[model samples]
Target: MTRPGGTTIKNSRRLKVRVKTGKGRTVSQKTWLERQLNDPYVAEARKLGYRSRAAFKLSEIDDKFRFLKPGGRVVDLGAAPGGWSQVAVQRVKATEGKGKVIAIDMHGMDPIPGVVIFHKDFYDEDAPQLLIEALGGEKADVVMSDMAAHATGHRQTDHLKIMALAEAGFAFATDVLKPGGTFLAKVLRGGTEGEMLKMMKRHFESVRHVKPDASRSDSAELFVLAMGFRPID
Candidate 1:
């Protein structure tokens, strides 16, 4: 399949995987299992040793935008399971000591080579200061968030929840990002709106919504990429 970055993902057609509704399995559980078993991205992620299939979403985005460059300092908000951090580490050459990747999450994550993990909720009052201190008082070249709220199964509720996280992430980005830095965060299908949209336009040279091939076609998820940060005087 052709992705937005003009990269073609080659996958051989395979027989569909089916799951039986067993004694302990609910219908939704069985459906989710079947989908995971049949997902090419999941299989490929396992083969490549990525922490999760979501890695491809960041990969596809960075491939097109070229923001995660070597020697860049990146702050990843809500980086649990560390998939995006893994990609960022390699892309930024953190392992070679040329860059830095600081990943923050409310939940604990196993360590990834060259990544500094903060097991704390970003909503905590002290979180921003901690992250900035970890950066040695230097501004970040990029701040990204793949954070999403737990789905309540109500569409509008879920959308609002995720948007709240995105907005919070953007606010934090403005504080830590160097001039001309990038901000990337996950959002729902309708994209950013109202004052948030206007703020992004004023602060960024360009802002756009990107849906990567790694995102399920039926999923409401999309990413907002705001590049070239222009902090106000």
Candidate 2:
């Protein structure tokens, strides 16, 4: 549909650029809204029927690495709003009865077909075991973590918090992944090339850091991809 001004209305949803004349519109909030409005992934997400644009980050990363496969068992850490969960379900064919996806997050998530979601903290004493059991006693082939701490606006502190979560996710993956499995987690640039990298190198055949195109260029976030898990003890 084309409007009188010759602009296409492909989606038909009203797109607005509301400017505040006065009050209730802070500079930061306005900037955030503008960014969201202009983001290509956000627009593509709506057109592709995804819950959130973050889905593209996972898709792009998986596309390059080919970590997800049909009939593969996967665990999604920090899954919320079912964005990544949705993609995992379709890619792994969990709807066809050949695979399972166990998603864990502290936040409540709307239901997604072919995904078993656990609304609990992954660090809870029994959460890891519960997720493993929910997979019907089968170890996971791929463990993916998109967990991030609530940013405190302090750069150093925020970095440390995200690293802590990544470490916890790594620990859970190590406990439940089968030999030759894979682990992927979000981390800051400063978080890698340290003790965590050393530990990953010892446990996996290869560890690579990736920044997907969907990720913001200014963001400090990157993903750590660990392939070929080697179970110790």
Q: Global lDDT of each model?
A: 0.89, 0.84
Residue pairs in steric clash, candidate 2? none
Worst 10 residues of 1 by lDDT: 3-12
RMSD over all Cα atoms, model 1: 2.4
Off by over 4 Å in 2: 1-22, 191-193
lDDT of 1 at 183: 97
Prediction 2 global C-alpha lDDT: 0.84
Q: Determine which window of 10 residues in candidate 2 has minimal summed lDDT.
A: 1-10
Top model by lDDT, which number? 1
Relative to the true structure, candidate 1 reaches a TM of 0.94
What TM-score should be assigned to candidate 2? 0.89
User: What lDDT score goes with residue 38 in model 1?
Assistant: 90
What is the per-residue lDDT of model 1 for residues 33-102, given as tens digits with 9 covering 90 to 100? 9999998778777877789889999998997899999999999999999999999999999999999999
